[model samples]
Structure formats: structure tokens, C-alpha cells
Target: MDLSNIPKPIWYALTAFLLLTIGYGAANHVPGLNSSDKESAENKASTVPNSSSVKVSVFDEATQAPVVGAKVIVESQGGSDTDTTDNLGAFRVQIPTTDYVKVRISKNYCEPYNQDLNLKSNPDRPKPIFLKCSVPQKKYMPSS
Candidate 1:
């Protein structure tokens, strides 16, 4: 590790590279930073019609109550979009006007709901989707 003869410019370049590497690694690990960046990039890269929108609402199957803070993902041939439901348990995501798109809705303690929708046939309005709670059943023990 004899660096006494190393040039100042080379040392500076190496230091800069190391700093950049550390900064990038730190940024990637920050909560919500990576996903937000990717989502923004995907949105900018999308070439779909801006007029088309998909409205997804999550509801509890048993109680028929709105499930807030649900994660909604819509995927099409163009790209994928992610959103979270509001207090009304609704997420309106702008999507490309395509023939078909896959929609997935998930929430903690609830079973994920997935469906392939025909956007062309469906009306240009928000659709309500229901999700059932995934309550684990207990096993019955036999008497000894």
C-alpha cells in the first residue's frame, strides 16, 4: 500500500469515485427513495394516452367497508404504475389506453386481489374492487 508516488489528480479522482459510490449506495437504501424514483422514471418514459385513467377502490369483503392505504399496481404492455389508496380506499392511476391491463390490489391482513381487466370494454370510470381478509384457520386437535 505504498502511495507516496501517486499523483494528486489520480488521488482526487479516486476520492471522487469513492464518494459517488457511497452516495449512490446510501440513496438506494433510503426508504421510499428508490421506488419513487423508479415510478417517476416509468411515468416519464410512458408514451400512453394521458386521458385514460383507472380508478381502483379496495373494500373489505366481510364488512363491505372501505380499506384504506391499500397498495394498487396496474401493469400493461407499456409499463407499470403504483399507487396507494386514499382515505376513501380509492386510487386513481393514469394508465395507457390499452386493450388489457393487469390490476393487483393488496393490503396488510387482507388477501391480495388480482384481475386482468379489459379496459376497452370497461367504462371510463373508477371500478370498485373487494378484498377478503386472509384469516388463518386453526387446526383441530384430536383428544388424546
Candidate 2:
């Protein structure tokens, strides 16, 4: 009926109900505002680039210091060479979205080191990952 003929409380309730219904319809149909879009965005965000390269660093096991010139080899699960480490004991290696990576760090002063890096989740770019190595100190014999 007409607003002037309806009771005031009923009029307010009807108005509130209509406003809520419009909002619900718009929220369901709008692309950027719909729940489906939010769900899709979350799914996309979970996806990782398999071909991306991640940077990892090697440090001395004893002192936790960066071991420059340390030899590091990165091999994938498929027995393919990804990349090699730099002089700073850092390596930029291209890995898969999910991979079993092998990291070998060695230096003249340290014992042979081997590590297995499981890269199932694609870590964001330029992330620094620290690895452990077997570092040995040189023995000093007094001038005998």
C-alpha cells in the first residue's frame, strides 16, 4: 500500500528488508565484489611458477658465517643441472613448482657437506635461504 497509509514501524521494516535484498543481489553478481572472484583469486595465489629461480645461500656450520668461494651444486629430482653458486656461496637456481633439490657445499677448510632442499612451495623472488656446511678449523702445531 501507500506509505502514508501503512503503519510507521511496518514501513521502516519493509524499507530495511528491501535495502538488504538489493545489497545481497549486487554483491552476488558483481565481479570484483563477488565471493566467487575472491575464491578464484585465492586459488591463483596458491599457484607457483615451476620455472622460477630462487636464490639460496650457504653458511659455515660452526660460525654461521657466509662462506665465500664455497662450491655449491644444485641438482633437481630429474637429475638435471639447475644452476651453480657464486663466489659468495650463493646460487641462483631455476627449480620446479615441486622438486627435491640437492645442495652440496664444500670448501678447502671444511669437510664435504651435502644437503637436501625440498622446494615444494614456490618461494617469492629474491628470498635468501641459509644452508649449513661442515666447517673445520686448521690445526696449528707449535714450531717443533
Candidate 3:
């Protein structure tokens, strides 16, 4: 094709289109460049399963009181899901598939908890997972 005959506007438009195509391709492949909404949608689609639920509860070890607003995460070879504890300190999350997964729970002013669970045997009823918080140590100051 002869490029000398092409108009300036047409060349500019073609250049802009080519640049846009390249940018879009790079954004999709580069980490953190792609929009989160699209990434989350893909993750959800790939991790979908027949559906199973797991309940987790967070509590203070010394006071034996429920810990509210705790974050819970369930991860497996396939994918992972996250949830937060309610006022009752309980969080229920849906599992993508019936497989072994690692459950992690964390809350402010409390110790984090992690455990590997096997969902193959008990799919319906899973034992409640508990987390213990460590007492903050008091700092001693020298007498002035």
C-alpha cells in the first residue's frame, strides 16, 4: 500500500486507534492496570461451584465474648472468598468447590487464626472455628 496518498487526518486517526489497541492489551495483562470490576467478575465466574457454606465464629479467649467485625477468608487451590463477622461474631461464607481449604480469621486487638479444613467428609455441618486474642503487655517505665 502507498502511504504518501493517505490524508493527514486519516493517518492521525489510524495512529490513535493503533495506540489505543496496544494500550488496552497492555492494561489487561499488566498487574494493577486492569479495572477491578472486570477482574472480580472473572474470578467469580471461574470460582463458581455447586455451592457449600462454612460458618466461622470469633471470640475473645479470656472474656469468652464474641468478637464482632472480624474478617474471615477461605482459600483453596481453585479460589478464595472473604466475609466479615456479624454482631454475633459469626460469618458464613460460600465455598466454591468441595475441596480442602485454608480458613483464616483476623480482627483488631485479637490474634489471627488459620486452619486447613477438609470439606469432602462434612459438607453440610462444619464445626465452628474459634479464635483467641492475646492480651496486650503493659509497658514498664523507669521512675523519674
Candidate 4:
């Protein structure tokens, strides 16, 4: 017998293991090599319109600066309120997607303003809207 000759079963087992590992990897990686395993509609629909966030800010119409500690109320179809603003005067609110309706801002020193909003609205991304404080009428101007 030749010493160079080795057991056939051991070589076969090694080859099989290597081939199995390669096949498994290719099946998962290769698109055309394996059957497609895709997500169902329920998974996507359940996550659609996932918007539930709103941003509110208060600024002086003349100064154009953020109003810190300003009171902000966001009334949507689902009725939601935004979290209090930070030192920078930025408030973020989370509401239902279908609830995108209107937003109201109030402050003792300034007038209140209401705006209609929807999920399509882009408020979070640095938008500036002018709001003027209510001016008191002098005795010279008579009320209606």
C-alpha cells in the first residue's frame, strides 16, 4: 500500500461541508440564485404614513428671534399637543398620521396664531412664519 493514499470518506466529508457552506451563503446573498423572500403588504401598510411628529416655534414678527418658553398647542384630527420648547424655543410633538389638522401658538406677551397642517407639511426643517402680537386699541380708535 502507498502511504500517500488517504481515507476516501474523510475527503468526501470535507468537500461536502465546504460545498454546503458556500451554497448557504450564496442562497442568501445571490438574488437570482435563490427564491425571493419578500415582505408582505401588511408589513408595509402598517408602517405607511408613519408621520406623527410636529415642530413648533415662537418668534417675534419684528425681531425674528425664537421665543423661549412659548406655549404651543397643536390641534389635529386626533387632538395632540407638542412637548414644551427647550431653551432654544423649539417644541416637538408627536401625533397620529391622520391627525394632521391645525396648530395654535399662544403666549402672554404675543398674539395667538392658528395654522392648518398635514403630514405633507414641513415644519421641522427650519421654516419661518411671521406672527404679530395683538395690539391694544387707543381711546382715539373706537371699537366696532
Best by lDDT: 1
Put down candidate 1 lDDT per residue, 1-107, tens digits, no spaces. Answer: 89978999999999999999998887764445565544445354243555477777788888888898988899888777887898988877666667788999888
- Candidate 4 backbone clash number: 0
| lDDT computed for candidate 3 | 0.73
Candidate 3: TM-score? 0.55
lDDT-best of 1 and 2: 1
lDDT of 4 by residue, 55-142 (tens): 6566678777777676766665654554445576676665557635577777666777788765565645634445675545657777
Query: What are the clash counts of all predictions, listed in order?
Result: 0, 1, 0, 0
Q: Rank the models by TM-score, top first.
A: 1, 3, 4, 2
TM-score of each: 0.58, 0.45, 0.55, 0.49
Tens-digit lDDT string for candidate 3 (54-105): 6666677777787788888888776677867879888666656667889888
Global lDDT scores for all candidate models: 0.77, 0.59, 0.73, 0.62
Ranking by lDDT: 1, 3, 4, 2
**Any residue pairs clashing in model 4, and if so which?**
none
lDDT of 2 by residue, 11-127 (tens): 899999999999998886444576463444322312335454556776666676776776666666533333345666675655444456676666676677676666655565433
TM-score result, candidate 2: 0.45
Report the CA-based lDDT of candidate 2 relative to the real structure: 0.59
Candidate 1 deviant stretches above 4 angstroms: 1-39, 42-47, 134-144
Model 4 accuracy (lDDT, Cα): 0.62
